[model samples]
Target chain A: MRIEEHPILDFKRGREIYFYYNGKKIKAYEGETIAAALYAAGIKTLSKSLRLHRPRGFFCGIGKCSSCLMKVDGIPNVRTCITMVREGMVVEDNDMELPDKEYEGCELRKKAVDVVVVGGGPAGMNAAIEASKYARTLLIDENPRLGGQLIKQTHKFFGSRRQRAGTRGIEIAKELEREVMERGVEVLLNTSVIGYYKRSHHFLAAADKINRIVYEIEAKKIIFATGAQENMLVFEGNDLPGVYGAGGVQTLMNVYGVKPGNVGLIIGAGNVGLILAYQLLQAGVGVACIVEAMPKIGGYFVHAAKIRRCGIPIYTRHSIKRAYGDGKVEGAIIGELDENWNFVEGSEKDIKCDFICLAVGLTPSIRLIAQTGAEISFINEAGGWVALHNEYMETTKEGIYVAGDLANIEEASTAMIEGKIAGLHAAHSIKPIDDFERKIKEYMEELEIFRQGYFGERPKKAKEKILEGYYEKMGERRSS
Target chain B: MKRWEREGVAEIEDIRLPTKEQLQKGVAIIECIQEIPCNPCVDACPFNAISMENINALPIVDFEKCVGCGKCIEVCPGLAIFVVKAKGEKATVMLPYEFIPLPKEGQMVKAINREGKEICEAVVKKVRKGKTPVVTIELPAEYAMEARHIKVKAEE
Candidate 1:
């Protein structure tokens, strides 16, 4: 288990690293990525699967899935769970794979473009639209369709009209896509950026088709609008067939219209967890319980009361002890934690549940960006090792800029603004700076306004963080 | 509707149409029928029964002195207002029912608790719907104290 009292997460933190697996000296951090530093050490299958005992690694370590887990430094089967890095952390790997099969390589692409945007989601589309103003922009998406996570979002957004308040997220996504199309931005759906490298003039993007192909394109700039993935949790028997990430539940029910199960237990009390619980009710599915390890619900009070007045009880300070199942998830065992963060003896209670949805937290997908030799920093506050970029969203490498979740971890609204900033800056680099200073000021002003609301306040801090460097530059310029 | 305050509920009390002497002069009638966020009932009436000037404020009803004339309840979301007319030994209550499974006249159904739980059985003597599907149910005067919610049974 993870540490119990982290400075940032406090009592919600897992246990301190104590035990070691397979005589390997692995350390767990107070709030670091268990899969990340472990991957750096080449230890996969942190734990065994429930039924088939298949080895699982750091597949979607953003807490989106329960694939990466281990009996951390003791405390059986914790999700090395997208936690922070700490000192003297000991983690062990279980369910080891046979040492015979050769590992397969990730697919790479052959076609080249001037500017390649990673995602076709809302931020990606907006970035492509803005970048197309000056540079030849090519938008690439792994999905067959365009609209990213917003397509599964059915609830109305809560912001001003400029941010499209009172409009459904999917509608806003559609509007953004149409706007991008109107700007004549080229879109390449079902295209994934397998790898990244720094060229003399630009960056080379490798993608996979039938076979891996390298795109040696001399691009003026690159924007990474690759959005976030869902988070997951781990417990005994958590890898059962019926268990899924919160986003997986969303994709299954909201997107595919296929019912995940009749009764469900949602672990995590953040906005995503609460929203999914509400959506499940709307879809005529029964919510068994909303379990959270925190003392209070993590989402807004309004969202909590909405579920409460509807008579759904939220259990706080409770964590899953075990998941009871055979080939599929049939039930789950949850227990109350004491002040020391230890599961109380005899406190375990079993509930008949077929589906367990975990919405713990998200980690930025920055492996490809890291592969390009960009300066990567492991910021605990900003998800994981994101590429370092300046106020213009450009990285240390001149032509390559990062946007959306791949750069810094933030929500969709802020990602949209960052994408616009990257796009505008990329365009400014390629074409004449047409009202560039004025546009930047206007964009920053609008972003400031959007940052004033309740949810926007968090990103406002992140914006200040990004702008701190720019503020010094401006001060120096004024002095000169 | 005007509201009347009475002490000690749960007992049958004699009620009848008020004589001309009891009718207040020029009581400004306020109809809150919009189901939107509005608080004209508190401000327009010059009375202190309403408190919510904030958005989405539910109008507070003062039972002691409201002249039952069907006003604020008409303007509530989901049409949740009722003017209880206690005459002789019978009480008539105006309610809002918007679901497809409508309750019919003389239908017997269980009254629900505040948490949507069933509490007591109530017989609907009459069923009436106005412009907004407002159903007025007439029940025995004794039931006026026990019944707060309503639910219909499936047809046999």
Candidate 2:
């Protein structure tokens, strides 16, 4: 089903179109993704698992997860979540059978730039905006449009006045996009950076998936603002078709106007989970309840209160044991957790719902930056393994910087500040700006204000540990 | 533990409620007890009634200077602030509401408390439309402090 009305967001759909799914004709819109159109038409099972043939639906709607990979237009493994639907296009489940077709040669392109920002989220856009002031900057993203995750956020942000605290995330994305365009920052969307080659200089091999072209980019500095991926939870029937990530549900409901399910069960009670619950209610969907393993709610008290006053129950110290259904999620088994983190005996209760959302946490997507020989270490407070970067947001390897979730998992406000710091420092290193030091100090001060709160304690400590490691590695390099 | 910590419902004693004299002249009640990294309410107040030592500190409202303009209600990202005023047997409570099919003027609705329980019937007095609409309701003075939200009855 599709959401017809919402309190906050307005879905401006494109012209209606028709497509084929598994040889059956399905209605779609011109701007709708294949996965979204299919979900809206009550087709949840997109693909099946390789080993056991388990059904899998849309999980991470940002094209990060492989749950929604389907064959489109004779291509074997196209990410349907990011590919827009065309009239009369044929989309089918990936059968792992290769099609016998001649391949066309991809056009090769080569260019050099002063700075290359590798993400289009809040961090990368800000980085490009700041870096382009002093250098020839280029921004790239793997999505069809810019604003990686911000495009789906419908709530206002929390920060100081300078960071646009009262502004909504979608509006902020538009502002950043306008700034990048006005500052003459080159933007390349629908492109994925495949590999990094340490030749005479650093060469980044990128592929334009839409245009069928390859670009060999040589840059003096690279800022990897590559965001993050949602973490999955393990349970019985967890890989079912209706089990979705919290961000994935947001993308479907807010971005594409597709209702995830009639009634949903949310796992984890962090900000993401709590916010998703509220957004679901706004879309006229029923929320069964929110279950958190922790004794207390992990999100803001205001967020909890907002939903609680609306008659939504929050079960603390509870965790989902299993999701059960024939081919999709029909319900879930939840149980209470004891003080020792063990499930209480006989506390299991069945909650009837059509879909389950995982909002457990996120890990930094460091595969691209890690391939560049940047030293990464495991820091529990920073979510998981993260690239070691100094106060300037530069990784151990010179000329390669990491910001946002790639550096650590934090709020978008802090990510933007980190991107600004990285961009300013990278540009100064190339062109020697006069106000570089002053601007860096100002950004660091803003970051300090954000990290001074109770919720910021863990991220503050994690960032300190990362900076300490960065300095130690630098000291060893100097001694050797 | 406080009720807000365990059940997500702020008890009257746990929050900074307005004094009887302050309630006579409509004062803002801030239910935000957590020390989050936010300070929009501080700048949203034109009378400078809301102040915080730092961005992370809890906001303290000066009832003596507050005029109950309801400006902070719209700016607060938490939607935790409310304005309550009592006049003899009746009182008016203003809250930030963001929902479809908003209650019309003079329409009867169910006034809900912090625990999501309907305490009493209330009549909608005024509705100021904006990004987050502010709905003012009139109810018994005794239930003014408890009512934080309103539920419109489904049309037949």
Candidate 3:
């Protein structure tokens, strides 16, 4: 049960209802989605991972990831995190069989457009708005909403007045979306850009839907803002059905209004893991513990303090040994690690938990960009594979541009600025390159301010290194 | 009226006294302990009684022109506040209580201090329980000097 009154934002929870998990009846709420009820009822481990068969629960409750994916009414792979439950809707777990016919690709329209954006997140939204100044832009998103991970963000953002500091991320997303639509940018929801290819001066986007329409956009430039995918960690019995990505848990609790677990254990100390821990408590679920292999917490101290005051312990230098259960996760074995990162003998601790949330890291979804045959590089600072691009986000391929997490994994604020540059450069192609240079300087300064505090060190350094290498590699090509 | 009387603030009832410092600050921090969500006291004051915007925002009391009318005390759902006056080694404390066998006027009772420790004997000057079952107990000068928060003793 949630606290009656909160010191911060007021929680206007909906009327209560009931649902069933594995044939056992459980109480939920009417307005809230299914995942919320399960968390409130102390149930976690919604399903297992596909390859590892690890128990996965809701981490990001925004439906961006498949951590909260479950079989609803005999439909597998349904994002139960965002799916609202109707009365008597049957929900099951521990199932990972693919559908009879897999979706080969999307039904694409062989039509031309001014520009095509591969994402509709913060970066994609800003890119569309900026590009609309010189071209008719098409913004595409995979989810039903445009916010992406912003929907699960209930905490106040830290930025200048222009970025709406002290305002919630979801509110910022709403404002950004409104600004984009007001600029007459065409926004397409529930549209996933499955592939990207460079042709002449434009990039063809193969999108997925009922009818796979391939949009052959005749753009002077294209911005690939496909974003990043969550990284998975492997362990013994990791293939259990009740583990999940950290982002998946956030989606389950905040969006679908369901609890991710009763006694939940989280791996990783990064912002994603810490934020999800707080969200789990807000959903009225007991966080058994937060496990991190690092010697210290990786997220902001304020975030750690928030959970610590609520009695959730942060176990440093600890790693999950294995998740044990039959078909579903019943418990997890956590052990201490030495300085050499080896498991210490006799230091193993057993925690009775149903769900383990993984927030290990993220890998850029650059498959489409790689398919474009653009010069690609493996940059660890970018967190994964990244297309070689100039400061203007223009790749080796003249008209191909990569923005947002596709180019580098950063916060949404930076991604929005990057999107703007990519969108503008893609519109005018040549003239906006100068404009892109000026915007990058301004954003670099703004980003410095965001990185002033102690918590900003690693990410700020990472961003600097990524930019430094990009400019270094470009040499005079960027000037050209 | 004799020692700690203020200039323009009216003491409509001798029980509820307004403090000199409160009069200077132009605000009164009324301590109401009512569990029910009632806002009559907020409405009863003519000079913007209290802000009732959220039904949850704590009430703000303006003391600049309160006049110590005691109308808010009469209307408060939870009889919590007591107008206090402290001066010259003495003080006046007004309290709200509902109990049978009310203390008689000028009767002496054990003066339990703020820490719930008995300090000295206190003389009750006035006791009023209207037909509404609401009672106001006025304690002596010394009781006001020490008492800030209060709870009544159960009669044996």
Candidate 4:
């Protein structure tokens, strides 16, 4: 099931190692996540669901989802997807395991940075790179690596020089990570930012999973590029072990080189779903069909065209009615959806499949920003609730800025552009730069050009509304 | 125009075809109809044959100065640029390819259209591999402007 070779990406060899899974020895490699090793070994049933006790596998391959949580080396609730494998590590499912013993409290540390950037994805990396030129910027990400989803994306980007068009995303991620490291941005990895305390000007509470050290940092300004979370479609047997997120499947197949499944069914036709379909075929996985509830395909036609030529069937106005299997997905039933978004009567058809993947949409991860008293509003067009920010991406709370999907759900190209804008703005707010206005204008012009395409029109309008709201609020504050 | 395009919901842009006069003059036909934010092709041309009024407008090809150098094909990231010329009964179509196990010179392959429909068999005349790989193939003059992709016969 492991992808020994790929056309685009080269998975170089690593030091061979061994780990114990339920007392059974399994071969692994150093620096590879425990979940990846298991998946490569064809162990998809990582854990079981909480109430129903149904088998659960890797979902959201990032640490955001707890589906891959397992007991590792006497530690409970270890995210196997994010946890690195070591020799002789004892791995067991932690879904039903009780605490064998209570460990001591996590170590604590305090420090201050000129600017602290949250969520080390494209947005955070750009923000850190820009802010570090003016101030001591500190970047923090939950994963051990700096690139968020960019690490998994192997497709070429779609924009001119400003968006790094023509460059594959995986290569771009490596370039960005190298630039961040070389530009002197202080990076803290394997640590998730959990809380923010504005009482002392700036307070960030970060928990490092590797060292079990909790960090408290005070900064003059901060940028939140925390990205978004995937959404699952509702259907019978949706929680089965074989059902996975579009990004989750990408991580399993692309990042770890593990085949997601022999046969699969994708639930959405958006860019995520469309891209996943093609990538699955590249990994030699047979996709039965893509079921989109919308009347038309939601992604770009060029993407759909590629899959069409590859002999994959896409069913528009259709929806997955149910997934049937003993414990994991064995087959699925799909039906057509009416205009009202309901399945039409007697339109159901059975499809022989082993995997059911969801690419419906994503919700912004706004827990920490909300904790900072940032004014967040629900905007469906912007992909659910996002933080309200000014043209400079400054949130309601002064000195705190929002960028990337945290501000609005978009892909890595625009997210990195927004990050550069917010980074420059936050840097100027912290310590004013002489070339601030020129840089902002240049970056904003490039951003405007990037948004001229049809796919970018909606996010462009949402940003206009956000700026208008900021100006209106500013006028009211001045009058008061 | 396609079905989804006629209904005004097409996400992919359609390419504007060149006139008969332009086709014979060795002018480039850029198959990018959308307002994408790309300007590499504009900068790639030394003759200034391609022009963009707006930063994100579809590139305009000047048939007189185009020269059919196919320089833009090397820089286009979307692999959307194609240069075609009709010479008697045969037509030379230069296309961008990125797949692995590339076709060699004098290789006979299936010529695919915009919709992935196989038009006919075409002979590979030249292969330019670099940051972008472009394969120039000679096909029937009737499929001069329609063939945009090459399918390796071995893959089938």
Best by lDDT: 2
Residue range A1-480, candidate 3, lDDT tens digits: 443432223446666666677888877666566676666676666766667665665655655566778877665787765566666768888376675333445354665667778778878888888888778788877666777677667665544444554456777788888888898887777556655555566556554432435454555666788888778788986656567777766655555554555788999877788877877765667788888998767664435644653456778889999999986778999999999999999999999997888889888888777887777777777786788776677887777788887877877766777787778777766454446666657765665555555545555566566556666665654553
- Model 4, first chain, TM-score of 0.95
DockQ of each: 0.05, 0.75, 0.02, 0.33
Candidate 4 lDDT over residue span A1-480, tens digit each? 788766566777589999999999999888789999998787888888787677888878887778888999887788898888999999987845565432358789998998999988899999999999889999999887889999898777776766777677888899999999999899999888878887768899988877888899999998998998889777888878889989988887888787877999999888788888878876768899888887777776656655665556778889988999987889999998888988889999999998889999988888889988878787777888888888788888888999998898887888998899999998898777998889998888877777877877888888877766666655643210
List runs of model 3 lying over 4 Å from the truth. A1-110, A208-215, A430-440, A451-475, B1-156
Flag clash pairs in model 4: none
Error of 4 at A148 (Å): 1.5
Which is the winner by lDDT between candidate 1 and candidate 2?
A: 2
Interface RMSD of 2: 1.0
Alpha-carbon deviation at A246 in model 3, angstroms: 1.1
Cα lDDT of model 1 by residue, A1-480, tens digit: 112221111123334453244665665434335554454344434555678675444434333345665655443444553343456655555334442221145443355556778787767887898888777888877564677788667665543345554455667788988887888887765455656665565555544322323344446677777766655566887666566678656654554443567789888887788777866765656788878887766654434533543345577778888877666678999888788888989988787887788878677777666666666666555666667667777766566778877766666666777788888888887776768888877776766655554445555565455445444443432210
TM-scores for all candidates: the values are 0.62, 0.97, 0.65, 0.91
User: lDDT of all the models against the reference?
Assistant: 0.58, 0.89, 0.64, 0.82
Better TM-score candidate (3, 4) = 4
TM-score of chain A of each: 0.74, 0.97, 0.80, 0.95
Instruction: Report how far residue A9 has shifted in candidate 4, in Å.
Output: 1.2
Candidate topping TM-score: 2
Q: Which stretches of candidate 4 lie over 4 Å from their true place?
A: A95-106, A468-480, B1-14, B20-27, B67-71, B153-156
- CAPRI band of model 1? incorrect
Candidate 3 residue A194 C-alpha distance from true site, Å = 2.0
Looking at model 4 chain B, report the run of 10 residues with the lowest lDDT sum: B4-13
- Compute the lDDT of residue A170 as modeled in candidate 1: 68
